[model samples]
Target: MTRRPTPLKQWRLRAASLALTLPLSLAVAAANKPAQGDYFERIATFPVYHNLAEGEARATETVAEITTASSDGSTLYYTDSPRQRLGLVDIRNPEAPRPAGFLQLEGEPTSVATHRHFILVAVNTSLDYARPDGVLAVFDIRDPRAPKRVASLATGGQPDSVAVSPTGRFAAVAIENERNEDLNKGLLPQFPAGHLNVVDLAGQPADWRIRKVALSGLAKIAGEDPEPEYVSINALDIAAVTLQENNHVVLVDLRRARVLHHFSAGSVDLHGVDIEENDRIQPTASLLGKRREPDAITWVGPLLATANEGDYKDADKVEGGSRGFTLFDPRGKIWHESGASLEQALIRAGHYPESRSENKGIEPEGIASARFGKRQLLFVGSERGNLVAVYDASKPWSPRLEQLLPTGVGPEGLLPIPSRNLLVVSSETDAADDGYRSTLSIYRLGAKRAEYPQIQSDPKQLLPWGALSGMVADRDARKRLYAVPDSYYKASRIFRIDAGRTPALIDGEIELHKGGSSVDYDLEGIAQAGNGDFWLASEGDGKKRPNLLLRTNASGEVLREYALPEAVAAQATSNGFEGVAVTGEGALERVYVAFQREWRNDPAGQVKIGVFNPNNEQWRFFHYPLDQAPDGAWVGLSEITAVDDERFLVLERDNRSGPDAEVKRLYGISIAGVEPQADGTTLPLLRKRLVRDLLPDLAASNGWVPDKVEGVALDTRGELFVVTDNDGVEDASGETRFLRLGRLRP
Candidate 1:
């Protein structure tokens, strides 16, 4: 039985959603070397599973929770709690980092901080949730090949976030005796509240003086449960600790082990926010009393900046940290709040997680700031968004967003190695379905355009668009094109694209409606109508929703609707009406809908392309031959567009991603000398001619090849365009690649 989430579990899922928004496109333009300019690009990626020792099953789970680099930025160290070990990486050659070694410990390593020649790890040894116990394990790493642990000290509770001072004189750990949300509805003020541990690092590792600083009676909410989620120490030895569940930030002097300042992280009224997880992205809700339950904290001079993940509910409602980051001074004076703009930017970049829109909207979890050359950069890791945002934070007060960097699932640890002009990030998500293990991504800032987010909606337009299945060029304007979503989104939308933009911009969108009320359907194919209306194909899955053909005006008002005949409807097996195209004019207009897979009566390797005429109120079918599958891959048609009066452009692709993708191409088929089969007869197979090979385009960016090559459109100048579906960031790395293939000779 599928267990329904309890109230507490529901809240946990809510927080999980905050951290779970998931899924990519790498496009054609990246094939050529980009011109030299200031931008960030992912240089390399090191999967944590590569560090598995001899005889270890490749299936063993591992994760990089917290990461830190050596002082010279040549070596990397990360905590892997699942393996109860510390993994090392040798990045002497920044572009190609190899596994150095691993240090298996007795307990789970939660966080790590590197200072000078030593690495400090906070280890959790708790037998249970209530009776929490931990230890501080110090490793001397003067030699990259041989890392030795010289000291260990008892921590009062379970430790989470750890930080080291610039002078290497002290280190601080946030003893987050984190509460299991499954217990007591995950309420606050439970016994044995957590505290902060300040250790003097000047002495021997084992003999370092450790001080447990109590942080109770400071925050307004759950004063006793002072669970410090994250801590950051600065040059002055002042540490900023975030009491995440309590929605507060506390500053402690590491030298004195005393609280110097404390204040509520405060609340902000959010506008234009998507509040419902209804498989849609609608920025119509407002959060008035949302708490900024900041989870990650970092220091910028004397001020502190936090990534407000908003992990738990503090009030009667289920609203916490309404998404984004905030910069504040030591006294808790708010310097600047990103408000809804942070998430809105993610939406514009085509990286927004629609599945997690209701839960903190791409939860910003980890943050790191460093100065390289003349500029200071701030990196914010969005756990659910699966991407890190880079910004020029030189001003300290106002940061300029530079680009969005893609990472593996659940980006939890961020380490900026400014000395090498490099940044490292760790993702903890381990998927069992595909053997997708944890990953570590390395990005370097150099003279180049940002090598990510091939397509994005206009920031000024703020169009919520993804999973684009079918597309059609504008009748009068080539640069203007319209596309529709698949079943991924609940909102039935028609999006307009401007192919002239760098990444091809989603300039605008129109929501569909029926009888003056808003309505939603699984819109797959869209074609422009003669009288400024649109012809839409809503797909069916055989089991429930039937195939529907709709005629709507530009404003999305339903003008006409048509259902398929029972014979055709009965033949569908979830692969119905994927694309639509039209030929002829006005009364004699012939609408063509492409069925994604082979139908009941069709050949094993052939699929039907149905043609409907409004004049005769009748339908006909034509068979399109499919390419042979390779190994575990299946080839099928995803889009069909009218190239001219007698020819059509069809998009054919395989069901494989990454290196396994063998075919992602376009084919041209003509009906000039052929006759479509009558309503109930054997379908006539149409011959196909190679139009273009899309594999080079998908491989140009050097990223993983995406599986869904869904939409294609042709401009008035005969320029070709293509787009891939991101699956609404659900269990996939949300990257949308929109490519302008340029003018194709027809």
Candidate 2:
């Protein structure tokens, strides 16, 4: 029997939804549903690199763009445009997907779909923008192991999307005669207009014939060049198509091979959004009349949903993209619009791409809808944020945001299989050097609640935050903790978190300031004082800034700043002052600051730990031994947490992610009777013992293991917590794994 969430747990989930900045209606709807109801949980992440031939170089660029599942839901197929191939994955056991090799295609596979035992691949064989051409290649996958090419038909032009009708009578292809951005700045009307191609799927594959349906002169903007981007066929033999670049939506009667209705995708005035690339997440900017250039469309029941992923900007600097998704009726009446809420929710989950703020926030690109038993589910993929926002579409008019699942970089495909209770997402971006390989993530629907968004802020406050670095638990509060963001943002802040909840909540924040003016610091470490104040350790840039220890009041007002002694500061490097912790009280109080790496004068395999005495205002140093890092990688201290007056814990990790990582652990040190050197010269080496190995905990998430395990804290009841730094989502996966290590003895 499925166990329902208790009243307290339900309240926490509701508060979490609000904290995630979900739409008000969505929050209420999600909270009111039975807790034991259906929900999707991520099961596995299959990297496309694994699909390469056994001896082939893994570093070779590969991507999984558009994906589709077999009718039996036993196998997965995706397009690899860069390699001009169709990759396969056997997901008979959805929890552990295995690579099933790949099939080389003649041209770039733009899209993929499955009907019965046939795999339809849209191959883009276009020579150029003026001369666009493509083929719909069909492969018989009846054997499931070895698929053979059966037949191929010429699509009217470059086909971007293909969909088979529910009755398997016909198939609709969006022949997008795409334009070249280099020519005329990619301005519209660049040649032959695009149209819809309907293929008769009756009889055999060789008997199929394409029928062109003119879609020209149907949109207000760039009507002569209608570039259809995506298509979805409903049960009534109707096709819903999205002309992304032209900002238009069109409906076609597949049975008649003619256009039924077309309407402008329109524009939206987005407010409460961040529209700057200024190294901060301030949602105070507004964009007036931004075009909703919907890229992907799907039919949910009788309604249509669009993922408005804008791609063009006019000469007047009129940008595209409404930063969200929209649900509309057949006649183009807006039934529900996500507006800026989705982007805001990504912000709360630390997945918002701040660098893309000036262009498109999150960029909802691919959308798919499927019915699981009695409930309808909608999945919206974020291209920039690298995640999918799942919604309950049981009520088509008012969809409820249910959960957000992390994906690979640039998710461009969303495929749901209700029969197998699985959803597959495919990513397009392939950057082997950056540790972000193209991947296909699989999720399964079950009774368990979401296990992501481990930390979030209150929606009522609408706090925009990310790049969490240091953490410190309150002395009196059982579940209260404090965390600080690194130099990712311009404003330095200390956030208050409620650690008791299953998915922790950030309930409040205090921006650091001095004399009515904000002060920005690369704060990597934080420690709470007995009087409720905070001690922060700011890292130096090695060029202009020097490492320093700062004291702040409970209200986040800086009271004092103590630079490293002149002699000690001269030997500092860029990786300095990573962690800070305080012990004792009054005159006996001593501050411990951990330097991340070896300094100019320190010996190899040892970093200095600066000790400060508040009573005498003197400084001492101790050398901490470092572990040997993997080749081309460096190990360093990330955090320090005080266990008591005599002992403390320090986080040590390597600058490697995914499968390359090796050193994510905690070390214990005691200063009960040891004496430190007065200066860096011949510093005393401190003895350390292994506390815990955190690599297993991070690997249990079924995703890539993040490298920046930069935060650690111990609460009053012996609960230990940890957090990772996402590098502000710049060339990174933007996944923060907030882990609780339960009770521990230092």
Using lDDT as the measure, which candidate wins?
2
Q: How close is candidate 2 to the true structure, as a TM-score?
A: 0.94
Q: Against the hidden true structure, what lDDT does model 1 obtain?
A: 0.81
The sequence of per-residue lDDT tens digits that candidate 2 reaches over residues 1-746 is: 01222332211112111221112122222324735647777788898999998787988999999998888889999999988999999999999999999999888999998888898999999988789999999999997768899999998589889998888887889999888889887888787888999988887898888899998898888888899999999877888999888899998878777777778878877888988888988888788888899999998876789999878767677484689888877667687888888888888888889899888888999999987776777899899988899888877667788988988788899999889888899988888888778888888888477878778777567787788899999989998999999998888999999998768888889999999999999999999887888999999988797787999999999999998778888887889999999998888788999999998898899988889987777999899999998998899999988999889998999998877789999999987788888774688888899999999999877777888999998999999999998888888878888999899977
What is the TM-score of each predicted model, taking all chains together? 0.88, 0.94
Q: Taking the candidates one at a time, how many backbone clashes does each contain?
A: 7, 0
Residue-wise lDDT of candidate 1 within 483-576, one digit each (tens)? 8888888768898888777767788888888877877788888888666789999988888998888889998888888888887787778778
lDDT of each: 0.81, 0.86
Model 2 poorest 10 in a row by lDDT: 11-20
Measure candidate 1: CA RMSD: 9.2
Report how far off residue 467 is in candidate 2 (Å).
0.4
Instruction: Return the lDDT, model 2, position 524.
Output: 97
